[model samples]
Target: MTLTEEFDQSLLPGELILLESAKLFGATNISPNAKQWEYTRKFPIDELRQAIQRGFGSIELPQIFGGPGFSFGTKMRIAEELSKFDLAFTFALIQHHNALVRVAELSPSDHSRELIASMLTGDLIGCTAMSEPEAGSDFSSLKTVAKKVAGGWILNGKKGWITNATDANVCLTYAQTDTSLGSKGIACFVVLGDKEGFIRQAGYELHGAHAAGVGGYGLVDYFVPDALVLYAPGLAFKTALQGVNRARIHVTAMNAGMLESSLSIATQYGENRRAFGKSILEFQGLAWSLANVATSLEAMRSLAYRGARQIMRGEDALDSAAIAKKFGNEQTLSGVAACMQAMGANGLRAEYPLARHLAAAKLLSYTDGTVEMMNERISGAVKKRYVL
Candidate 1:
């Protein structure tokens, strides 16, 4: 069966609506030349803006805030469907959605109402800046400091590997207000890109997802007045960790979509290309490999949707999210590699998407949180709950 047939049978009406919207957006704007755009590192700003205007990216925001107010399961399906067409482009939209969600959580504040309005109208772009060069996985080691001043706080330090940093209109940033307290001293703030002392620097030469603007920046004594502070000291990291549970769910959905796409490509190629007096797929080795890929995809989807259901019910999902993210992302890489191997030289070609899918998998594996961190979290949770 085809991807659509499988999806149509499984998804609800609301979920199908978002999937159709994503397919239309991808067909019109992204799928045609996604490879060339990835190669040239050119972000499709106008197309993406149109997508946001069409309500494709902000579905998770509450209806009170001009969003569709969909369930978390619907959000995951949206990410998965969009990613099947283009991982980098889907990622850009996912990042924007995440920022909108963060703004919603931090609303009723001075700047949030206006900012969220602008985001829904596509007048602004949003991103998160938390990772620094020296503080990849260890939030405790972040050196960016927000020194309390007479009027407000003076921010200083640099952040690296920030998605959408070069193009975002606003950033949700975290910094230490009291290094003596380590992670406990961390605070969050809303920093406008056009503001003075907020520098947008160039990102590394990337292998994939160039359109996502994975870059870095420095805050040179940037003064953020009290009005712009989102989370006070001792609360920034808490908010960040709270956000991760949902982010991991979307990340898993993205990986599953890419894996399904890769499998489809391999399946189509294997049926048509013949060797040894028969189709390659007729061989048990290749046939079983594809079967295993399908099985793995189903397993990942089960884990991801279980976590999404928990989140929808307002229950704790950290453990489920970690398991889904770690297993989903890791399996996506392996599955996509198998698909590429099935296609042989064609998979390596830039014209095909397998190679780019591999790059996207690697990119996601490191971001959000690493597999090692997930293992630690699960082990800790298990020990705390199961100890007699």
Candidate 2:
């Protein structure tokens, strides 16, 4: 069997089906011409539509809600496989779960059922609005306000660096319902993209993950119905932290997959290219560097797998997830850079995956949280073990 197949069989029966769905999605979305697409930032939307049509977006909700209701292990596995090709595509599609889960958390059973059904069938492309112009990482200090009105709440603030911002039909926004409560006063609301007082704009030029179509949105005192309120004040912070931690794990896996791609390219180059009348693989310097890259790749993958398993086991994986993100992103950038060096000028050229992978890995180091943030989280956890 293929490597993917072997990995699939290692998972539970439910996980196998999700993996199948992901494999099908990957086959349709990931281009053999990935370099061309990366350079151009023009993805094949029809392929995305095809995957969604096959129910790729709604595999996590329960059957009672018309969702496949796959386990966390399955979700992680599916993300790993899909991100192996292109993280941008995965980012664009996973919004369904993020949005629907929030709906389930804040809304009643009937609303959850209806929203989840729509989420799976491509009718509800959703996004989270947490990062404002001033509150990218420090969500507690956000100035966005949600004030009570006659039939709904009025929203006023700007959201920056949002993924799937333009494409999403709905956005689950977080705004401070009461400034008196500080972070504890924050609350979540469901805002339609075309709602009154909502203004959308393009974001600044991003380096990598450009295909994700990130943008900015301005809520010029937008109004959402009282029915649209998601989680109340106290719950917003809890869910934001949880979602970010979960996203960190996925970022770890994406880095792992990108590192593997880079190493594969480097090894193939070493085996085929020759210098000084000998193959590069036979040269001690190139061989040793390749060895280091391979070792680092395995180590990062090991860490990410542990984090994924922790998520699978239904345990709190925040600290472990942060560690995995820290190590995986650092290792991926270093490994890809080394691979580029091994390839000489060819690696620098756009024809190679090394350049694109290196860029992508660098960007990932800061996406969910920076390496510095991960270090802080890990250090704090360590301090809890004993007085230092």
Q: Per-model C-alpha lDDT, please?
A: 0.84, 0.75
The C-alpha TM-scores of every prediction are 0.94, 0.91
Off by over 4 Å in 2: 1-10, 106-117
Task: Residues 70-169, candidate 1: write the lDDT tens digits.
Answer: 7677777777877887888778777888788777776486478888988887678888888999998998789888988887899999989888887887
Give one digit per residue, the lDDT tens place, for model 2 in 1-388.
6333444555777658667867766856574645555667754455555566676666666675666676655666676677667667676666656676667655565655666566566666678888887887677888889988899788899888777776665788889988889989999888878768878786446666665667778888788877778878898888788888778887777787777777787889878998899898898988899899888877776676677677767889989999999998888888989898888888888666567777778878877888999999999999997767
Which runs of model 1 end up more than 4 angstroms from their true locations? 1-15, 106-111, 385-388
| Candidate 1: residue 54 Cα off by (Å) | 1.2
Estimate the overall C-alpha local distance difference test score of candidate 2: 0.75
* CA displacement after TM-score superposition, residue 353 of candidate 2 (Å): 2.9
User: Alpha-carbon error at 306 in model 2, in Å?
Assistant: 1.5
